[model samples]
Target: MTSTHRPDLPQLMIDEAVRAALLEDWGRAGDITSQATLPAAARASAVIAARKPGVLAGAGFAESAFRLTDASLQFEPIMRDGDRLSPGDVVARIEGPARALLSAERVALNFLGHLSGIATATSSFADLIAHTKADIVCTRKTTPGLRAFEKYAVKCGGGANHRFGLDDAILIKDNHIAVAGGVVPAIEAAKAFAGHLVKIEVEVDTLDQLKEALTAGPDVVMLDNMQPDQLAQAVEIAGGKVLLEASGGIELDTVRAVAESGVDLISSGWITHSAPVLDLGLDIEIA
Candidate 1:
């Protein structure tokens, strides 16, 4: 089978996203408090410091946040995305007009903290299943507009991405089965309509469903929310006939056990949607 080369994401998209965030904060009168408090010619130097440990992502977006706010601002990244960060580590150094610094600080941290949180959360799951063949994968339960950034964080944390969107693959779920009348019919419909390039996966809730799904020959089978014993049974049934994915209610405590059940992939949504932000601070000094 042939694979398609996906182009690297455009830097312009990150720049425009940063610009939009800045616009949201700036509104009609740009940084009114900063305009009133800081001198027009005053300059400040600052260090972007971490207050918690995490695997970093979104350094480029943070730099874009400051640069898009003011062309004269100096935004430098000392650490790249995927670098492991520790408390008190300096992420970057910035020197610019004081007003610009104050105005851009929150937006920069918003991107850095949120993305780093996702990277860290993914890394935790990846670490738990490191001994197994199962790969940690993130779900589409990402922030509505930030799916690209969140998926990138998953990669940064040593996890793989499943499908970027519904357009990428055919995944027949329980809902589709309900509509189509049965697992076999759903799988058949997907195969009939999907392009040759698209691979089909089916979600099975029980061993009976798994048996039915296997007969239809999907490229992958998802064992949703099954106990370890049931998953082991599914693995035996599959016997390498197709890739198996375990998903639903996956947490750090239970992920390793699920991976040990011999599934090929483990997916979780909380890694991106519910991860707490990493604590980061920008300390400034007037110079």
Candidate 2:
């Protein structure tokens, strides 16, 4: 985790996302079940509690969901984003018109659980590699509409983010090398084409390619699927002149060894695209 800072999402972004989710869930008639069961004047209080242990994220989304459902809704965040959550922990308290509270429940918990899951998964990877200098990083394989949210969750779990999009950096892969004739031409072309502020990175699978790519001076070189021994050799070859990133086949069980290889960054796509949703539930308090 950033550890010193609280995790946050911009309110405007939260409101926009929650609004779309509400619209999708409500459909044409709006929460018909809640409307039929509860009187307009009826009021209720509810708590969003965790059903499993995890890190907290996306409290902003929960607040926005209830407020957007009905402005009068009182949504109090008992636990902020980046906080550690335990089973049965009360994350938030919601009190308002019964229909509004019930209507927004799913959308609120959906963001909370999904983002928290990514955070939790990231923490698992980060914890094992804490002793090493390498920083765990998340890749671009994120859910289509929720990349920013998922990446934020990664930050909360003590991991860093790679380029948010292709436009930000020049990443030369093997295919790009093939298209450009060789690593030298590809790096030279990227260097010439990219402006002063843009960074260049390239992926290499062998020590020979590493040797060839190093001559071009990329900002970072990704070592794809290299074993810890290979990575150690790559590190020695670079001699701190360029950042070395280890990617491919990284997992919780083997992350420590990868980090110990003396690489600067470990990039994994699984953290964002495949993390399980943390279990959370909203229960109305009888009063």
TM-score of each candidate structure, all chains considered together: 0.95, 0.97
Candidate maximizing TM-score: 2
Q: Which stretches of candidate 1 lie above 4 Å from their native place? A: 1-8
Candidate 1 collision pairs: none
Error of 2 at 185 (Å): 0.9
lDDT of 2 by residue, 178-212 (tens): 99999989999999999999999999999999999
Per lDDT, the best of the predicted structures is 2
Give all candidates' CA lDDT scores: 0.90, 0.92
lDDT of 1 by residue, 109-219 (tens): 999999999989998999888899889888999998999989988887878888999999998999999999999999998999999999999999999999999999999
Worst 10 residues of 1 by lDDT: 1-10
